[model samples]
Target: MFGGVTIGEFARLTHLSVRTLRRYHESGLLAPATVDPDSGYRYYTADQIPTAQVIHQLRELDVPLADVAKILATEDAEERAGLAGEHLRRLEAELARTRAAVLSLRRLLRPHDDTLRVELRKIAARTVAGIEDVVAQDDVLSWYDEAMAELDAAIESRPLGPPGGRYANELFTDGRGTVLVYRPVADPPVRGRVHPVHLPPSELAVVVHPGPHDDIGVTYGRLGAWVVDHALAVDGPVHETYLVGPRDTPDPAAWRTEIGWPVFRLAVTDVMPGKNPGQTGNPPP
Candidate 1:
């Protein structure tokens, strides 16, 4: 400890715990400028304060320990800044997700009166271009993005109707299940992974989920309760129609999704099944 300050002063100056400095020592993220062989004391040079502060800031941002080490080891100032910047972007994304979750929780607890609006309609049988896959619940978003992109590329013509997806209950219950995404095209052309999917005539209890899909679960829960209260029995996979979404618009506030449950005794006026199921519409029952 001859050339550098004692660990006690270093801790006070850096505002870090003595134990933390020792841990950082063991982890090799920060090393003492000198160590006394006889007394086993650690010492850090005054110049090391800025590096310690940087490590503290990075740790506060939740950067991984390995990344912190890599950043500290970087010699070029620009390269170090770039590494830290990348982690900042990731932290920003995490903060956005956290904010979304908080807003969803607030809406769930408030229970909006208009959130329960339900529309019962008859959907006729039809064939559409689709891509099907068995995806884990966590992977659904990414898989949907890729599938929808493929569907869009294959079906260059304007969609006859909004794109839709059929999700099996097992996707939520057991965490993995079949998910089918389809675009209503006048004539479904099969190419690569795209296939013509035949949908059956179904009576749906539908509800509109407004805004970003982050809180769509809230709308889904309310719709399920409505179905139960109305004595409607869910008979098939849940249907989700993207009336307005990322593919059509960049603004999430303008996105509108239809959550439909194919149900029995849905109180919908009957309609004939045909190739174009969308033509079948009944007054909201």
Candidate 2:
């Protein structure tokens, strides 16, 4: 009203809708310079055009309404810039996630050979320095990192073999279960969460998964299918040997993980009923 402009005229001048102006007034983000008591009309001055434009720009960036209000209420120019910068960082993170998802989806849609080279191995039992916890699936990454750091610090010397872990089936199926990370040591010092534990020997159907772990599930699926086809799968926890992981190398292409599933040989009768070739009903010694 100071500039003799109605709400409609201000809306056109600011390139903002009347509805948005009404909302900004109600939200206390921007109030008109005057309101007619008799006609219940809203009026704005020329000074508010810049304020309305700023609000429109902030909202266009998808900034939350509360944050927008905070930015407007702040008197310090640096504080206002910081608030906007924080939201920009969040948007950048989201964009990164979107890019990763797109790459994964492209790989999934493109058909490629699912055949993986697998091996049968018998591992001997050994005592290892280890940590076990019931962890949620979402927290597994950070939990693993911390657990590995603890084990590295506790062990005085290098590991006897590659770092490995055992994951209970329920962990994958139920999204929360037991996970054990271990490093083999000749004589490991037991301190803190690190303790000496015996790992049992077992026959395993092992397969190597190369590259990053983002799509390792596809390799696991193929390996499980192989085990089922051979009728060698047993009810036991899955073992993982990190041959070349993030700690070993920064290049994901060079990473190699050995996935082991406990298995047992099928009996002759089970393989071919009533047609035995003098084979014993036990795994090869």
Candidate 3:
């Protein structure tokens, strides 16, 4: 038999609104202890107060109603704790993503009075320990992290140069293509998805992108514009030189990356000669 206390009393005890309690009752999440046969009034007991309070807390954390029901219905305390823990992990992941978005937004909305300096460099062909795979655009960051970790483990000696990557043009235009990450090392060996790659000499229009990679797209956009305005584009994979990165510094402000776009040279830049045209360090503001 169901015990008796008015639904309003249960709502007050739980600090939940009467309307919320009614919705929960209709959804079969928190059924009242009793219902009057004639008046159709709902009833609850003092024992139901804790269950209502638990449900309220779970809802406040934005747990799905079905998951909330499981947490409530489970009789074993350990089982309930496990259910709560799973949602806790999910909540933490969401909070991290939200914080990253806020940081990126702040950088994007702020005014940039500085010009992105672009350099013309001709890199010589070299052999290095590398990994290459076809990957989707969304998976680049995760893939790079895994590949770099593997590279670090496989190579024991000091690196000849900083780590770098080549992102095929199709990867950006078509959303998926080849990605290669490497560390320049002398006499690199072939081992478990890591092998020696002979990179061909090529010319690049390079720009240094500063800070965390969250707003890196902005720098990319600026650099691409410079390339289009100043030189003939070469159909080659885009290169990124990790100068000062997460592996080198914990502070995001100190991170510096060189974004290099492969290009064919024009005899003269597509610039209007109103002043000194030799100034290539900083492009048009």
By TM-score, the best candidate is 3
> Local distance difference test, per candidate?
0.86, 0.85, 0.86
- Models ranked on lDDT: 1, 3, 2
How much does each candidate deviate from the true structure in C-alpha RMSD? 6.6, 6.6, 4.2
lDDT of prediction 2: 0.85
Candidate 2 Cα errors over 4 Å, as ranges? 1-63, 68-104, 267-285
* Model 3 Cα shift for residue 62 (angstroms): 5.5
Q: Candidate 2 residues 89-186, lDDT tens each?
A: 88887876676566567666778664567777799999999999999987887799999999999999878999999999989999998999999999
Q: Top model by lDDT, which number?
A: 1
lDDT of 3 by residue, 182-279 (tens): 99998787889999999999888899989887678778877787777664566599999999999998999999999998887664444544646557
Q: Model 2, 142: alpha-carbon shift in Å?
A: 1.4
| Clash pairs detected, candidate 1 | none
Clashes of 1: 0
Q: Model 1 scores what on Cα lDDT? A: 0.86
In candidate 1, stretches whose alpha carbon ends up further than 4 angstroms from where it belongs are: 1-27, 32-54, 64-67, 70-97, 111-115, 266-285
233 Cα displacement, candidate 1 (Å): 0.8
Better of 1 and 3 by lDDT: 1
